[model samples]
Target: MGLGCKMISLEPPILCRLPPTTPTSFRTKTIVFSSYAPDKGGGAVSTGLPKAHTYTASFKTLGACKLGISWYPDFEYNAQGGTGAGTGSKVADDANELSVDFDIETLYIPPLTSSTTKFLGLPLPTFLKIDIVPQLFQGNINQESGKVDLEFLAKFCFSVGSVYKAPALLVKTVLTSDESKGKIRGGRGERLDEEGNCKLVGVAFVEPIHDFFMDSFLT
Candidate 1:
């Protein structure tokens, strides 16, 4: 009987980069498996996969300035997914497209003060103060392109200490990272950056309210 020798060929493993996976539940999972490739020294090296991320925006332009009437001092708003809001999801059929919705209502704006709030770059009168109550802040952010467009609705209540308080001014606008044009007023916004900082600008039309105080003030 003659003994026969046979040779076997083994193929190298394939390496690929995968997109980040959306978290299905509160639990975090390892969404990506590391892909390894041989280096010049024949040692395996990993080309890391993308991971899901969240962003908190620090607004640089939160107020308006027009005809010497201005509202100054920027504010910070953190955008996160919660009970009524939707988390990031792929918007288009393309796997790389992702968009996140923000419906924030719990956070309150810091009390307005002369030191913080200014008019025409001059400090507001110490006796005068305003309270901002956010009713709804819903928006969509394109993750890849850094574009942001939001519908903001809030009430600005003016007060003069314990003496008097006026009816809330219902302020509503479509804030965006692009130019916001209106018949009387317009603004421009900046796109979200890597550090989650951007300037959101909007043009709001002030509708006449039935309240005597508000009407008188506007007129």
Candidate 2:
């Protein structure tokens, strides 16, 4: 009899980063619905309300601002599920991309841009506006179905002449290209119907990001 030997090869498993998540609800420690006339004697009222724009706002301040996020299909990868259960199919790490947008009310900005500090500091603007537009984010998609839950977290402040000022925090999230078809539900149980008109919009596949706000009154 002759002796024979055989060799076997094994493939290694691939690892990926977990998908990003956005909160569906939020709670506020302090909130107030306030109104003031920018020109008290002139009858010019400024309630910080948003005027038919791609932004969501609180009417308690000087103006309205918006935030948005978007996601796109990774047509290049198009990989099917092999990783695990409910993992579905997956787009390549490089194929998936994310975008963020911020539409800040210009009126809230100080006439002199130099008057404000670079970071959060004293003498803060009566109101601050921050805007972000749809832009690519650096990361990967772990799902095979290309489904994503997008979130835009914001903490904003409102100030009135240094006497009345407070912080407003919020978290906005939306499901992208899913069964819902990109419809967003607001904190107050409001639904954003018009795609372009909604303050936060999601497309392709989306995820979450954070924002900040502060307040101080100036005479």
* True-vs-predicted CA distance for residue 47, candidate 1, Å: 22
Q: Per-residue lDDT tens digits of candidate 2, residues 1-219?
A: 000000000001100111222112111110111223234366555567532212111201111211122121111111111011011122224323222222332112111111321222233253543221212111111123222223323233334554544443232333222222223211221122221111112222122223222211110
- Model 1, 1-219: lDDT tens digits are 000000010000000000110000010000111122324565654568643344332222122211111132222111111112323454555454444433454333334556544555676688877665656655565656655555656676778878888777666665555666544334454555555444455555455566686565544
Highest lDDT: give the candidate number.
Answer: 1
Model 2 segments more than 4 A misplaced:
1-149, 175-199, 202-219
158 Cα displacement, candidate 2 (Å): 1.8
Candidate 2 has its poorest 10 consecutive residues by lDDT at: 1-10
TM-score of each candidate structure, all chains considered together: 0.57, 0.22
